[model samples]
Target chain A: MSEFEALDFYLMDELLSDEQRLIRDTVRQFVTEKCLPIIEEHQAAGTFPTDLIGPVAELGMLGANLPEEYGCAGLESSTYGIMMQELERGDSGLRSFVSVQGALCMYPIFEFGSEEQRREWLPRMASGEVIGCFGLTEPDAGSDPGAMRTTAVKDGDDWIINGVKMWITNGTMAKIAIIWAQTDDGIRGFVVPTDLPGFQAIEVKGKYSLRASDTAELVLEDVCVPGDALLPKSGGLRSPLMCLNQARYGIAWGGIGAAQACFDEALRYAKARITFGKPVAQTQLVQELLTEIASEITKAQTLCWRLGELKDAGRARPEQISMAKRNNIEMARNTARRCREILGGNGILDEYQAFRHMVNLESVYTYEGTHQIHTLIVGNALTGLPAFG
Target chain B: MRIAVCMKAVVDSQARIELDGDGNLRQDQLRFEVNEYDLYAVEEAIRLAESDEGHVTVISAGTADAVQGLRKGLAMGAADAIHVDCDPDDLDASGVAAVLAAALHDGGYDLVLAGVESDDLGGSQVGVLLAEALGYASTTLVVGTNEPVDGAMQVRRELEGGEHANVQVQFPAVLTIQSGINEPRYPSLKGIMAAKRKDLAVKGLADLGFDGAPARRVESLGLTIPPPRELARMLEGGAEETAAELVRILREEEKAL
Candidate 1:
């Protein structure tokens, strides 16, 4: 593959600090040199690239935006978003792993866990000696996590969790799982060690979307954890929703990456592949598709940059994040389809990235609050009314 | 074993090459990175310093943009950095050598390392010239080095056509490193963060007491891209006819009969 030409139509690079640009470039190099080579093979084999975890951790990608005191990079929100963009440029599955690790798993611990929990886990997790997964979505609770059937019952200063979590990313290999369950008080998060008795993570197999990632059905049959394992500050569905906000912000940026990857593949193919004695890129129809994709990508980049700035300022609302996630993922989905169309017959092949991203964006479109869920969230914010039944 | 590594900032390999009407590079349009060869020199220095428990300092002579390259060195675990504040356009290779020598003269470095050549210029003269200016023993195309023993270090050099030579250079020496001496590591996030806190002292020519404008003993005669080569002709014939044609051309066109 040719080197990724960063699509900075608005010259967004000028807005980034030197450190932020360096971080983004470092991750970009890692993607080009490490991830792109093996990702297709892994996706074909339906296996995760486990070897990259060590390198990714050494780069401090996990929990990158957290505080340096707990062994993180302490980067700004925008830098973290940039990291996601570059990582997803390689593959959405790869970005999903980091998002699950940083935003879903490690973030809750830092935000709501006890200080001892943060001290014990964050450093090891930062170094990649330990891996983590988040378990919130269930067979029944896809969008409304408040309706989750998982229960955490009090038993002699230990919580006995009994339930199943579906679509858990990084589940099988995680050393620990951050499980959000319904308690007597409300929906709460628990830091459950995967090695504990009655805890099992069965790999969800034969997945077409996100094939390079490890998804699993995590079952907790009366799993017991100490009282300290509870995330002290977490309460109600809002806590888990906050975690989703973090991951969604990353996905908002990640959508652009997937779109850009497909766009790059299609552009290269259009310029090189000859039809009717002329390059397809020279044709008006092909040019139109390329232009539309580029324009959408530029708009998405602008949106994400402003969103990141707002997040760093602590002024970004959940509905605003919903707008970004919804708009960018839908934009990416449309771009991927058009790019795939531009590739014509070759679009179906895994050798080309268009179809691969086309399928992957489908999963991205649904997960982390589906397109419909976000639309309502934003709609509600605008109308001052609850439309979600 | 306090070591100093000399770095050079060159145009990034991926940046589009645009020459001015005068046949010089459009400097403002280019993005500069640490010279590829200099990474090997920096890596070797860091490795030696790590094993021998010494400090490594990186120094470079270029414009303000050169600090970005120096920061890369620091991120690769160099103990500190020294930036010789001067426009590279103002200096030839000799002037660069003089600036580096002036910076390192008072630092009392036990060894100095530099790349065999800059990626853009490919002059391969800076290290040797710096050695001469500082009155230190020097070796070029050094591929490997052993630990210092009895005030000298064993070094391996690559000669022409895969031949190798081993020599022992005394302390306070300069070694121009070749590529493949070692695989340079990506700067870890921890290293990148720590580099920000590392000491980076920028010195000017006046501060180094070389107050006069540098004399360019060898000046550049501009640069131009070589003309594109003609495409090769394809043979349009059966295997037997093509083979016969190739032999005929070899005998007649080349006069090789």
Candidate 2:
């Protein structure tokens, strides 16, 4: 509630160029007032917040982290992270929708699509008229996307795609999908509409994590994409990997939001919950748990602040991101465990949200390259030997 | 219309306030800032300037340290600034108004804007006396504003019990903007650097043909701390019990709600 207090810990905002704090605060207020109030109910109901799309667009969070000429907010990378942090502070699933819409969809198009491609799609995405999802992970080749068997063939003016993508966020509701397939050129990303023939998205149904988001299986069978729909500059596995990097940067900061929430809920509960005629907050064990939670939160916040700096300065590397994403989410998961113990019987119940975080991190822990995969990536960087097979 | 604004340098709201020997807030060592309410007025003047493409000069009468406050106005897009080194202790609403009016008398400005009150001082008589002394139409504590038209400005002034009055003033006018009139924008980083090169005219009391300042000593400064008293018993009970205890204590001892 007090931005001035947050500024003291994460002065990441101070490193911005101009008008960045204003943009950060505007999105912060929106999250605090609008998102936080109804997020729990929506998350519990396991439904995507469709009403949020227009407001998110109005705040320029839809197609943020892009050039201004293409109807984007064109904010600095730190500003984008601040927006993601505020949005995820409400719910990670809600912020994930924007990440998919902006970074996963608009970014590859703006970076690789021809001029006509930019004109046709960016403005609509900016205005929230269109929602999109990325199709890259398969039922088998999630962590190692290069092993995917999806294929696209050149046929006249159209390209035929045949593939299946699993665990696609916003898959069921999206109007378009940035589908990555093995083409003759190499592994490439494509813009495929949901309305195309032989393209279908089936709701994955009971999901233990990110339930509020529309997780689905995106299936393509001879789905004809116009030749121009193929991303012009995106070739090899690096193109789709770059999109993952953008999403991971947001996720790196988002983990702190989840950790902070768990810590705050447990802190409040510990102060109020009484056992043996004394507040649990006064117990040495509970205090120790809280102290650990606070330290991790503060350190992760400091790390992410620098991470945002590296991103804004154009020096952010995948291995550098591998460290934060792996460290912070595990830290968050541990904090969630401490919170669950503090709440005792109340923790498992829906009223406390500690268990939800614990379960959510299990999926978040594995998605966007599994935690072990990231550890290996970092280890490989340290030893100067690629350990990942 | 060319307009001038006079602002005060107060300590930042978030800064911890301590009572000085004078039994007032000790401002030393704290980051001094422009009054929060005045920020909305500055933003309004900027809005006027943007639409009308007119000149706005901000003036503040304090020591050289107060130039920081004036530079804040410049960074908010003021045309220029003026800082007059008037002693903070010697200032009253009317006397400061006289100093300001003397500084801007021949500037050919059509309007003047100021905050209704400063957080440090409860008095809100400056804009009225400034307009009166300069023979300009005056309105105080404006809560809302309408688009400028026909060489006049229309403002909504609060009355007793949540009532409001729509008042219009001709070209030469003064209006004290109420707090929460608008949200002031953060000065762009570029604006702060740009403000450093902006010309800030500093004038002395003699420069205005003013022999000296007006009357003071309405209040005297003293150095004594209040004696500490024993702590009251804080009730720790259910909401209903706490509410009943509060009501009983209010009725029996305070004798008024």
Candidate 3:
């Protein structure tokens, strides 16, 4: 009961199937029992809970929404969204780990890899036997991935890959990496094993946000891979962008989870902590903060739910995902800040989750396409004009 | 071995309980989950079945919401489930026991497991009454159960004053599991999906050939929160003066000196 209970103001459960509800409840219980208890310590120590990988895989969460042929759960997209929401309710770091493994790494292999590659990796990755990471962003290219300096040269039947992928989630722990690079044919993806020569993933330290997650800078110098390493279906940058869209959809749901956590903490603290002869929750100013956050969370829930439906129907566009990610993350950031203020001095401590979520929201807001980049994407869709130079 | 676990869906103990004008719980504002003790029983049953290469069947007697608990049990690897469609408000502990006993009498189960008590009512009578109704040997407050030996099971029972007694019961027995017997596993995603496809048989009280009326019914009088404690008075003076005043108060007022 010390953990935050999810707030469902609009009876959104009515929109979900029974299986989806069961999945959500299952993940919610897992988060409450497993993740909530150890998150603060892990976050403080700046170490991922590596022991959780086995249990998490047992939950069928790694590639839950993918096809069952790949040893996934074969759940609907909305169920996956709910899983992400519950994971983020525990910590953004946990959700980020799942998003990287499922959407960024496994998704490309499922969507663009050859049948042989999928056969070789998907089941193992799904079972947590082999961890995977996605490499797209470089030190110079954060928003503009098309301008990445990473290059791959064809050498007989093998390809020599040379690149430095920055801010890579699961980088240090990944057994294999899905590296997006520029090739003579065009931008392409290569599944390079992390044990290859000249492949080094150095952990990034001194992070104030997402501290429990493993983020690293991947250096690949003269890393060689066979012809089959190249994803056969990857044509251009759109392939990787599609994977980002998948991850961003999960982030959209995850932002709401963080916001809910913040709001729950602030509400609980407001009712319990007394000031001026009464609970702070009774005051109008504090009430305003709670109401605003509650309202925004409800709105974000509706948007994410609709987007999930669209995704399941295969009608959702990247622009739509951009809008949800941009809006919900901003909502989460603002709500986290307000909740921190409502918690007074206690909010600054790691004992309370508001500050942790507030700081983590900053990282979430910046990564997976920043607020400005999403705004431009929406703007281009709205005005029917490419705004990016 | 086919083990049967009896579960119930109860209001979440963590939620603030509010009483209605008629002295009944406010159902609209409350959330429900599988009773805590029942979850332990379900876990123990699943463990027994898994180790013995047997099957588990979870059964619950409650309103429509009880299906949630049954599905949760199924998602935790129960082979199937049965729900006795009866409202808890309409039945006493004996009535529920009768219904469940009737269902399990013909269930062909080797063993029956239930919680020592429910979270809402805290009535520790259902499992024992169920054993009597089904004409089965039963034990309550069972902390642990050893593997089946020659169709008999050895169980460790928690007695008063922190004592434990080991007892052996033959097959077709009942055990009311105590909490903390085992840590229940969360339902895996595949299990959740599988639960959706599993057969959950819903039967009415009459289908079990048991009357819906309770042998004894208890009505709630009212519910109220206990009065808050009085604030402690701070002695605002030097340590010596405060000690002197505190001694005086304890001796003259509190009478503790």
What's the lDDT for candidate 2? 0.81
> What is the per-residue lDDT of model 1 for residues A1-389, given as tens digits with 9 covering 90 to 100?
55887767788888976566667777888999999888889989999999999999988899988889989988788888998998899999999999999999999999998899999999888888889999999999998887899999999999999999999999999999999999999999999999999999999997889999999999999899999999999999999999999999999999999998888888888999999999999999999989888999999999999999999999999999999999999999999899889989888988888777888888999999999999999999999998996
CA lDDT scores, all candidates in order: 0.91, 0.81, 0.91
Error of 1 at B169 (Å): 1.3
lDDT of 3 by residue, A4-121 (tens): 6677899887787767878887888888888888999999999998988999999999988889889999888888999999899889999999999999999999999999999999
Q: What TM-score applies to chain A of candidate 3?
A: 0.99
Question: Roughly what TM-score does model 1 have, to 2 decimal places?
Answer: 0.95
Candidate that would win on DockQ: 3
Q: Interface root mean square deviation of every model, in Å?
A: 1.5, 7.2, 1.3
Model with the higher DockQ, candidate 2 or 3: 3
Q: Which ten residues in a row have the lowest lDDT in candidate 1 chain B?
A: B185-194
Share of real interface contacts recovered by each model? 0.33, 0.00, 0.76
Clashing pairs in 2: none
Selected candidate, larger DockQ, 1 vs 2: 1
Task: Write model 3 residue lDDT over B54-135, tens digit each, in one string.
Answer: 9999999988889889988999999999999988777778888988988888888888999999998898999999999998
User: Which pairs clash in model 1?
Assistant: none
Kindly report which residue pairs in candidate 3 clash with one another.
none
